[model samples]
Target chain A: MTVSIKITSPLTNADVEKLRAGDKVLITGVLYTARDAAHKRLIELLDKEGIALSAGKLPFDIKGQIIYYVGPTPAKPGQVIGSAGPTTSGRMDAYSPRLLDLGLKGMIGKGARSKDVLEAMKRNKAVYFAAVGGAAALIARAIKKAEVIAYEDLGPEAIRRLEVENFPAIVVNDAVGGDLFVQGVEKYRGTGND
Target chain B: MRKVSVKDITAKVKELCIAAACHLEPDAAAAIRVASEKEASPLGREVLAQIIKNFEIADAENVPMCQDTGISVFFVEAGRGVELDGSLEDAINEGVRQGYKDGYLRKSVCDPLKRTNTGDNTPAIIHTRMVEGDKVKIKFAPKGAGSENMSRLKMLKPSEGVPGIKGFVVEAVREAGGNPCPPIIVGVGIGGDFEQSAILAKKALLRPVGGKNLDGDVAGLEEELLKTINGLGIGPMGFGGTVTALAVHIETYPCHIASLPVAVNIQCHADRHKEAVI
Candidate 1:
């Protein structure tokens, strides 16, 4: 069974724990956007923290925050953002576990995640949600405000803080090891009624 | 000999690029509408409805339907009797650079190893063919990485034949699951040498979505593959319902006696492409 839920960020352990795979969620809050390049730089920054070389701090604190994996097109005049859709999440699997361990509560992207990331999500009480992969124009409508916060040199891959309202997503992985992709494929397999 | 100036080509390419980004092809839009009505899962139907709405919004707002406007790929057929005013390749690349810049399309091309953005989305992948006429026809396809990454090519034993081909195609989609995005269009290229087969598969995608191949037997095979794929229950967005694939397009050519090459090019629902004649 599926339920519709509205969530506001920054999320909490209790909020993520309440979600189940297959839940339809409307997220209204701030979402941080970053893609592969930004993720790599972020991890490098985290690594530098131990060296004491004066790299300073992360652009934004990630604890209990959601990061959307996206590299949007340039916005036109009068637009808050351009067509902004989720990129494939599997590309970020290498860095996800570390971010989740650092108190990142949620991730928004399309496609599957690695097992290691899923396990980390379970351990951290975090959740993985999927925004529609190719519905960029429609998704951009939900983003009320957008501004670059870090890695401005990375072009579209730069991290931006987005103020969104009623942004839609589906919970694909929950804290309890529930996976919508596996269950959904199994349930409808061989049912060629169409 | 007839001459087509580089300026004319640039203008046409720019127009096609913007049009492709903003508009969902009529055939693709209609197919999604039909899929929504036939979808068995409530979630699947809803996803399809949202896709339809996205198309409507993209067209109205003049925004790209998806953020990854993709690497520009062109298929050009030039007439033997036509003379070019300038280097055809440079003109196409310049057109792509301008189109991406002016249209607000994303520049996705990068150095695979060095990982540097080209910024202008230049040096498009251009394939050219010579024909008898005096006019040139150009087809532009902006292929996103999500679906392009999922594409597969297999060199099968000639003995494996049709059943083997079918199995390979089915398995690829099943493994792809939701990554390529559900309700995809599968392009299959059969026979030909390895590189030729891959190009054939991509060219097959230019065929109208849901349109039948000219050959009856091939069309029948396409139908069979479509039914088998949808039966896997991948559903829309892999959310678990009906309508996994909207169409399967196959293009075939003669090949070596011992080798059978097959390539699958998967396309997401956005299906951004356009054509022009000069």
Candidate 2:
């Protein structure tokens, strides 16, 4: 059975703990957008900051925040944002573990994550959600506002903060190591009886 | 001989860019609708429903169906007797630049290593073939990287044959899982040289969804592959259902006796493409 729930971001450990693979969610509140390019920059900034406290710092506070993997098309006049859908998540696997360790709680993107990412999520009590791939126009409707916060020169790959309402996604991975992709495929395998 | 203006070609290409971005081709839309009806999983059904609604919103609002407006790839059939005043390639690039800018489409092209945006999605991948008529026909397929990245090609030993080809195709989809965004359209190219095989695979996707191949034997193979793929339960977005692929299109050419080349070009459900003739 599938259950639908509403989640407001800057998510809590408790909030993510309740999510499980197969649950449908409507994520509201503020979500940050970044794709492969932005993620690489973020990781680099963090590394440069080093263990020793320096004047250098991350551009934005990532703790408890949810990052959406996306690089939307430019908006037309009178539109808040253009078609904004999730990109594939696997490409960010190399940088995800570090972000999760920084207290990032959730990720919204399509596709499976690497083993390292799943392990990191398990350790950090993070969750992974999948917005519909290629359903950008419908997904953009949920975003009420958009503003670039960093890496403005990256064009579409720039990091933007979005205020979203009722943004639909399904929980593909949960803190406890649940993965919907594996479960779903196993359940439906050979059901076609070919 | 018919005279075709480069400006006219540019205009047509511009119109096609926007059209392909905003509209989900009718055949693909129909396949999704049918898949939704046949989907057994409640979650899979819901995903398909959302896809249908997404296209509806895209059409009504004049927004791109997906953010990745994609790499502009054009297949041009040039009439041998037709005369053009300007370079065909430059006109195509100009068309892409104007279309992407005017249409507010994402400019995804970059210098791979440097990762600098081209800003105007220019220099489209154009494949030209000389045909027997005086009409120039163009087909534009805006291919998103998500599916394109998952596509595969292999040099198979002739002894591997049909069974080998079948296994390779299925494994590619299985490995792709949800990344390519199933219910996909699989285009198979068999028996060409390395580069030719890859191009053949992509070209096969130009065929209308749900249409059968003209060759009966090849058509039969398409059906068999389709059934086997759906059986893997990749489903819509890999959430699991009975409709992993809407169609399997195969294009074959004669090859050297010792070598067999195969390529699989997977296209997501969006399948954005359009065509025009001048």
Candidate 3:
């Protein structure tokens, strides 16, 4: 049985907390973007001794938000961005727990999560979603706007904010501690459900 | 006595780079189609077919096949008799700059310490060798990050032999699991020291999928390794299916009698690469 989910625009913390594993999401919302370098910088700033992103003082509030881990190629003339698709999320594992704690609701990327990340999602009531890793052109259709938010020095890997509608993804992990990769593998392995 | 201009080199490299990024090499595309047909698992077959469709759409729309357009790596064979009007290094860098720019490919390189993007995608990793001909040959492999992250090299005692080499390669890919993207192409570099082995392994990716290893004994090992890898059931994206690996390519060189060095360079299904001889 397949479960489906609808993610509305201008999402709030409440909307994100409701996602479950195996749910197919038709996400219509605004999102933020950050790849490896941006995530590193964001975390470093938070780690600084005297610096802080207190609830109201941070650059942006992440509660009920979705983050896409992507570093798209530069777009051609008349295009907004090029090859805008999800990158491997595992590389962001170190910084994710902190973001989750700070009210991150959902993550969109390809591949599996680290053990610590999975644990953080369970504790924080966030969800993990997967976009087709290489389907950049297809995914780009969902984006209505994309602009850099911070860390411009990182080029394509820099952090940005995106507005999207009907972005497609499948929930790979949920707040209840279910894991799609693990379950998906086990289901077909013995039964030869090929 | 043959003269080559930096502009010519740059233009050629730039053109090849974009071509490779936008289009799947014919052989690789063919291999994916064949794999899709032969895959036993319905899920695996579907995954394989989607990958093929991805290549088609990417080519049709002139977009990259995957978001991680990868670091710019080049293997060049230059002729001793040829002269470049400007620094060959400059020409190569200029080409990468233009390629990434004009191709709309990702500029992935960064300052290792600062972790800041170079913006122009300059200072590409280049390996050059002088060959007998007057024409220069170039191979471009825009390798993605996921596959590069899973690459590994191990130095073993010569006594460890074939079985040892096989075990290490399989272990590295298994540990990588879904991370590298499945139906991987495993390039095994045996012999040579650490760096040399890695270079050889990367070079092995230039071979067409299903191409036989030159060494008879190593070729046998290649077949055996391919079989063992498929048995892991990691499948496409490690989602669990019948075919985990599409092919394993092995290259070897004579090493010190006491040393056996092995390096594995894993390539995901995207496998975007190209070659040119001029």
Q: Pick the candidate with the highest DockQ.
A: 2
Model 3 chain A lowest lDDT segment of ten? A185-194
Stronger candidate by DockQ (1 vs 2): 2
Error of 1 at B51 (Å): 0.5
Model 1 vs. true fold: TM: 0.97
By TM-score rank, best first, the candidates go 2, 1, 3
- Which window of 10 residues has the lowest lDDT sum in candidate 2 chain A? A51-60
After superposition, the stretches of candidate 2 with alpha carbons farther than 4 Å from their true spots are: A1-3, A52-56
- Compute the DockQ of candidate 3: 0.40
- The fraction of correct interface contacts reproduced by each prediction comes to 0.69, 0.70, 0.38
Per-residue lDDT for B1-278 in model 2, tens only? Answer: 78999999999999999999998889999989988888888999999999999999998888999999999999999999899999999998999999999999999999889988888997799999999989989999999999999999999999999999999999999999999888899999998799999999999999999788899999999999999999998889988778899999999999999999999999999999999999
DockQ of candidate 1? 0.68
Give interface RMSD, every candidate, in order.
1.6, 1.7, 3.5
Worst 10 residues of 3 chain B by lDDT: B41-50
> What TM-score applies to chain A of candidate 2?
0.95
TM-scores, all candidates, are: 0.97, 0.98, 0.92
What DockQ do you compute for every candidate structure? 0.68, 0.70, 0.40
Q: Name the 10 consecutive residues with the lowest summed lDDT in model 1 chain B.
A: B233-242
